[model samples]
Target: MKLKTALPYVLLLLPLAAFAAPGSQSGEIRFTGQIVNSGCAVARVGALSAAQSRQVEIKPGLKVEVDTDRNACGHQSLPISMSYEALKTSTDKGIVTITYL
Candidate 1:
């Protein structure tokens, strides 16, 4: 009779015993990150004077020069080289391509 009465209680406590077992522990998960400034600024200059408001014609094979400023970038920024190519689309539109060297 006693065995039958205690059997139900033992079955109910089995799951609780697993969670309270020896060497059981709880810990917190930690995460860390940082934000940094990067990248340079580029400016384009056309051959036309500032006072001239007319549209300037650019030849297909002409080479355009651009100036880059790195003063705004952080000192930790590394030196890098780049190349640019010009491609003409089927619709007679111009596309500029940039490559990192």
Candidate 2:
């Protein structure tokens, strides 16, 4: 019968209908946004004397102290908090650089 012969062709063409139009197929659209961390401005209180400018090595167990001027911030009532983050470089292994914005 003609209907039997055309049934196979109809089934094959049904899948091709999905590709008939370029980018016309119904699909889910997704939108994404990211919030990047921004760096805070820090004011150092004391003048950097020549003695303080010397490069010092920070050992794992030892602690190095650097004095900063919190008065410059002017927010006396609010507690001051500091955070440091290290970002790894794509080209180097075991090497990280800090970014300040």
Q: Highest lDDT: give the candidate number.
A: 1
List TM-score per model, in order. 0.26, 0.22
RMSD of each: 12.9, 13.0
Q: Model 2 — TM-score against the truth?
A: 0.22
Q: What is the lDDT of residue 97 in candidate 2?
A: 27
Per-structure clash totals for the candidates: 0, 1
Which has the greatest TM-score?
1
Tens digits of per-residue lDDT for model 1 on 5-101?
Answer: 9999999999899978865346655578753433343223464233322221235443443223333222443233333434454554454443332
lDDT for residue 54 in candidate 1, whole number 0-100: 23
lDDT of 2 at 70: 38
| Candidate 1, run of 10 with poorest lDDT | 48-57
